[model samples]
Target: MRLFGYARVSTSQQSLDIQLKALKNAGVKPSRIFSDQASGRNADREGLNLLRLKVEHGDLILVKKLDRLGRDTADMVQLIKEFDQMGVAVKFLDDCISTEGTMGEMVVTILSAVAQAERRRILERTNEGRLEAKAKGVQFGRKRSVDRNKVFALKSQGLGATAIAKQLGIGRSTVYHVLNNP
Candidate 1:
């Protein structure tokens, strides 16, 4: 049976070196290893697509971690189902779970559920914090750089939105927004 390895990082800034090394140490050859410098939530990763195209029955797929495979529980579960249907096996090294047996499948399912719940909790906490900060008079988004008083002064001087924007080096949309709001 051939061994194929998959690795992923959330962003281009994060290094894939650790995952790659782990996959290599797990007996996955360099040529059989595939990686994507993209989010685990992204399904259209190029390397993963290529790996899917190349994988066949009796081939074992190895991942450094369950999360490295994907962040979304539904997507991850669906992928495992697909692989099982294709007569392929998946092993998550970090989690020490495999799709080769019934127990492994059960454990993976439970862990995936926990991971999904954890993600939801994190999002809820973040939103609650943001709302609390907003209630405390904290502002969000980019700081408005366009001077509203300057825009009004320019408009009074007979300069149109386009002319005002050009003079202030800001977008015409900003000038129009300032005029319309104030």
Candidate 2:
């Protein structure tokens, strides 16, 4: 069975050296180590893409942390399911997370469920808070797109919509809205 490792950092400025060291300690070869310096929000990362393509049945993919695998629990769970179907094993060194056997599957599932539930609860609480604020007549969202008097002044000064947008650091659409509606 082949052993491969994947490492990632949110930005190019961050170092992958720590993860690489951990993967190497886990026995993954230097040649088989794939890395990407991109955000987890991006699904088509270079290193992750190459690893998925290169890994075969009976191959094991090692990671320093479970978060290195994907952005969220749902995303990681889906990826794990795909790897399990392909007979590729994924092992998270930090969390002892694996998708190899029945016990491993149970652990991953339980953890994923707990995470998802927590996210849902947080969302519900945030929405409730927003609703309560709205009931008290709280204004939300971006306060008026642009300064009203400024747009009028710029227009009176013979500046075009695009120019007003650039000068105020607002969108051209906002400039038009302020000019046309007023």
Model 1 earns a TM-score of: 0.90
lDDT of 1: 0.90
TM-score of each: 0.90, 0.62
Model 2 ranges off by over 4 Å:
112-182
In model 1, where do residues sit more than 4 Å from their true spots? 42-44
Where is model 2 poorest over a 10-residue stretch in terms of lDDT?
A: 111-120
Q: Which pairs in model 2 have colliding backbones?
A: none
Q: Which lDDT values do the candidates have, in the order given?
A: 0.90, 0.85
